[model samples]
Target: MGRGGPREIVQLTGDRDAISSVTFLADGKTLASGGGGMVWLWDVSYLVKPLSFLCAQVGRSFTQEEWERYVPEGPAYRKIC
Candidate 1:
C-alpha cells in the first residue's frame, strides 16, 4: 500500500510450515490462513487498536528500564494504558 508495494502491520507466527493461502471472512474481522494441513482463524479486529488491546491483556506497561533495554532507540517511555 501507499508508495510501497505492500506494508506489514502485524505478524501472526507459530505456523509450522509455509502458509499457502489466506482469506478474510465475511465479517471482515476474522482472518484465516491455511498450511501444514491446518487452518487457523485469527481475530483481526484488534488491529484497529492493538496497543490498547495488548495493554488490557497484559495489565501493565513496560517499566522504563525494561523499555530502555528492549527499545534502546525508541522514544521516551509513555504509559500505554
Candidate 2:
C-alpha cells in the first residue's frame, strides 16, 4: 500500500503498457488494472503472508497456512480464530 509520502510498501507492476484504470474488487483482494490492450486482475491476498518482505526479496512463495497465520483470518480472509 502507498502511504501519504512517496514511499510505497507494495509495488504492483504487471501491465507492460500504460495503465488506464485501476479498481479494487468488492473483496479488496482482487485488483483490476486496465490499460493498453488488455486488463489484468491481481490477487493481492497473496501478500498477506508472514515475513512478506523477506520472502519477496528471496523470491519465495508462501503457503496457505502462512498467509492465514499472519492475516489473522485465514487464507479466505474470514479471520475467525
Candidate 3:
C-alpha cells in the first residue's frame, strides 16, 4: 500500500461561538452554512477564481443580529419573518 495526501480542496470557518453546521445547496452554485444560531446563503459560482474567497468569508464574522438579518426566518428553509 502507498500513502496519499489529503484530497480535500475547500475549507470554511465562521462564528466560532455559534456555528453549528455547513451544507451545500441543491445546485452546488451556492453554499448554506449555519452559524450564530442561524443559516446563511453564499454564492459560489466563481469557485474557479478569487470570488470563492468571498463565499468562504461570507459567514465568518456574523453577529447574532446579523445572522438573523441574513436568515430572517430562522434556521428553517422557509423564507419568512
How many backbone clashes does every candidate have?
Answer: 0, 1, 0
TM-score of each model, paired residue for residue: 0.51, 0.45, 0.40
Q: Write the per-residue lDDT of candidate 2 for residues 1-81, one digit (tens) a residue.
A: 333445434678775567889898888778888887788888787555545544665475545666565544323543232
Alpha-carbon lDDT, every model = 0.76, 0.63, 0.59
State residue 28's C-alpha deviation in candidate 2, in Å: 0.8
Q: By TM-score, highest first, what's the ranking? A: 1, 2, 3
Clashing pairs in 2: 73-79
Q: Judged by TM-score, which candidate is best?
A: 1
RMSD for all candidates, in order, please.
5.0, 9.3, 17.1
Question: Which residue segments of model 2 deviate by more than 4 Å?
Answer: 1-6, 47-81
When summed lDDT is taken over every stretch of 10 residues in candidate 3, the lowest stretch is 72-81
| Model 1 residue 11 distance off true place after TM-score fit, in angstroms | 0.5
lDDT of 3 at 38: 89
TM-score of 3: 0.40
Best by lDDT: 1
For model 2, the local distance difference test gives 0.63
Q: 1 or 3, which is superior by TM-score?
A: 1
> What is candidate 1's lDDT per residue for 1-81, written digit by digit as tens?
454456666788856476799999988889999987888999898866765775787799877787687545545787787
